[model samples]
Target: MVDNSQGHSAYSEDALLVSRMNVKPGGKQAHMRDGWFMRDGVKVIQQMVYPPDHPEFPNEPKGMKAVLAECGLSQQRLRGKCKKCESDSLACCYKRILELQADFQEQKSLMQEVIESMGHLSIFLLKFTAS
Candidate 1:
């Protein structure tokens, strides 16, 4: 006979089992707050919490250097140029190169198709002339 008047069963063991079932198998859960993770004894930031101009992360040359590195451009070759100018020039040049490559591939495919058609036509003509 269990007491049902208090909404909870008379067996406290059932409540404990239910609570434990909700918990993950990990040793401890990491709590996230404001883009930070508290794991074990360490407090870690999930992202760049500081602004670019912050002393820990300088804004000027580092950004340009990162951009140049990503674009595979040499900083020494573009020493005097502004970041925007260099980036724009690189973007335009890359776009032109990509367009040229696409055009070359299309022309190559078209040439292959033409060559195959010519071979078929020549074979047909040779057979017709022999007969």
Candidate 2:
């Protein structure tokens, strides 16, 4: 139960889950509270500060670079400027997620082809390897 100037309401189980997730592991006390989900907090902060489709950031890579700079991280991983950047805010996340999914699917397909080519020899090799 929590009380405020407005009123009091019963705390739900979801509230408990949220509290537990924010707690640091091993009971170590942390002054700075974090989000319930374990993700890139800096990236989340950057996203909040400079949303995907912000006017200044019509381009995704530029916006991401700016945010990374603010967070004191070098943009070594980001490739050169993108010629065609998505304008829609939702589309930004969607496009990157789809690209990642496609890459993963391609890798999975390649792995399957390799496994198929290995055939019975792979199984025999696996059996001999130490557990």
Which candidate has the top score in TM-score?
2
Q: Write the per-residue lDDT of candidate 2 for residues 12-126, one digit (tens) a residue.
A: 2222111222111223211211111113652242221224566753322223233334445433544423345465532233223223322222322222345557772222111
Clashes of each: 0, 0
lDDT of each: 0.29, 0.29
With candidate 1 superimposed using the best TM-score fit, by how many Å does residue 11's alpha carbon deviate from the native? 67
lDDT of 1 by residue, 1-131 (tens): 22223232232221111112212222222221122333466654432122465675432222222322333442343332233343345333322222222222232222234445677421212112344
User: By lDDT, who's the top model here?
Assistant: 2
- Which ranges in model 1 have alpha carbons more than 4 Å from their true place? 1-62, 82-131
lDDT of 1: 0.29
Q: Supply candidate 2's per-residue lDDT for 40.
A: 63
